[model samples]
Target: MRIWSQCVKELAQFLRDRLTVALAFILPLLTLFIFGFAIRLEAKNIPVAVQDFDNSPLSRSYIERLYATNQLQSSRWDGIGSPQAALDQGIAKAAVIIPPEFSRRIKAGETSPVQVLVDGTDVNNARVIRSSIEATTRFFVRNSQLQTNPSLIQVRSRIWFNPGRQESLYIVPGTCAVILWIYPSLLSSIAMVREKEQGTIIQVYASSLSAEELILGKGLAYLIVGLGIAAVVISISVIIFGLRFAGDPTPFLISTPIFVASATMFGLMVGTRVPNVTTAVQAVATTGFLTALLLSGFIYPLSNIPFPLSLISNIIPTRYFIPIIRDGFVRGTGWLGVWFYLLMLMLLCLLLFNIARRNLSRMQLPD
Candidate 1:
């Protein structure tokens, strides 16, 4: 009954607080809308330099095919000495060099290799450019040869996860991860700081309410709110953006509360250390936003990050949870595949809760 009353009190306070209301509801929606449009995984409108030395009809047709895909655009590089020079001058993201023998090799039924140079400054864009060019070239070759040779071998490819490679499908789950961490942590910490500002924390300390009870009460209130926010954002992703969940919801269902608890406790710990609401919000933002964005394998894979940084990512709770959400929703991995991450989330939740409890126990009343 006491815990329930505390939770109700926290809920009422959350409702009354404008900052908490904004953080809980408005901010998540705004972030979802912004990131939904901004973070695109698919590469589009990439400029490419074409050096068609062959001056053949086949070469011209191949260049047209590249443009038809809308992934690559031909860059104007009339004065460029070589495809490599065009790349050096940043005239294009990639360059295609078609040798003079390209058509002759095709006519003689011999394998002809085309030289492709890509600017590796952005590795992801470079990979996309290389893949798009290769796919276009293969399509051109297969179709062009089919007219003279009916028995030419043909290859078919299919993408299993995220077919058609929709960027929203890839980004929304990660955005959910980022939002979950930032908002719950920010709101929970601010709630604690608000208690200090209103001089209610001393009353809380003087009461018979245990630290665990206080923490659990505050955390439970935010947990329910966070889950509701997550559902709304996910529905927006599914209904509006057309994201589909491919796997069982059990893994995601099990991990979400654990993730939320960890985030809320992290905020509580921050609130205990910081003197005011502004400091707490800034702390939560810096810690939650940066870690979720950079270290959680959201934008970049942990495997690709350099040695010690990769080692450091292993400790971030979001690092484990992101895969759980991605696999359960996107890749459709069963429990056997995701059990490790689930266990890690549970352990992280325990650790964070323990630290927050200790911090709460040691909290000093404002002077």
Candidate 2:
């Protein structure tokens, strides 16, 4: 009961500290809100230009269908001007060029080539626009067929992991990984800095406690808080935001210890070197934010980045966790595919902990 009271008192004091409160609660929620709204992959409001040389009902109907697609916002240019002009000037994403012989070819039971000039600058959006155009064109061709015998060719599409392309499914899992990277690092770093700030670290080193044992205790404390943060985020994601949870708990269970251990070791290293809590916070923030943005395969696809940058990214531990959390949650992948990541995480923790322990054993505070 006495220990519990003391713990509660310390927690209260920690909470009352304005800076601690801001870092713990305000900044994290602010980041979550900003990133959730801004960093989406879904394309909207695709612009298209139409040049109808045939001026027939069939051609007009086809153009109408293109406008009807909610994904596309289309405009008509009634001139023989260059389709390349529309693409080059950024006036359109795609241009539909209906040749003069369109109606004549339809009447003769022949296929007329309707050229679609697409701006391939933004590849993903261009692909979606092209698909929508092709689908709409095929529909028009099928319905306008006046032949005695109708022929049809069916195309099938298969999407793995997320068939519906639900952005939340991909995003929520990736967000979970991002949260893991920052929260664990911040928590562990603060735990060490707090000990140093209170002048308890020297006594801890002077005592019989081994570096490994000290690290373990610190790891357990921060692990409890990290799990609490995960639970809160998960609850918000599932109950408030309606994100799905379709996978086994094995990945989450397995990754938590590795993440916490790595975080604790990193914190110890930072704490031992930086003189005060403020400097430690600065160090962690610089390391945490840049590492996540550049190295975690979140913003840019790892394969697309330059070879040298990719090599550097491979060394960031967060890179491993992002894929693991994403695969487990979105793809429902079992341990078979991601065991290598788990192993890598374990190795990182061991290496960092060894260095941190050595630093802690030799370090003395400056007067």
Candidate 1, residues 1-107, lDDT tens digits: the string is 88788889999988887866876888899999899888877788898888888989888888888899778987877844877887888888898888999888878
Candidate No. with top TM-score: 1
> What global local distance difference test value does model 2 have?
0.73
Cα displacement (Å) at residue 204, model 2: 4.6
Determine which window of 10 residues in candidate 2 has minimal summed lDDT.
Answer: 1-10
Off by over 4 Å in 1: 76-89, 99-115, 146-157, 364-367
Error of 1 at 226 (Å): 1.1
Which pairs clash in the backbone of model 1? none
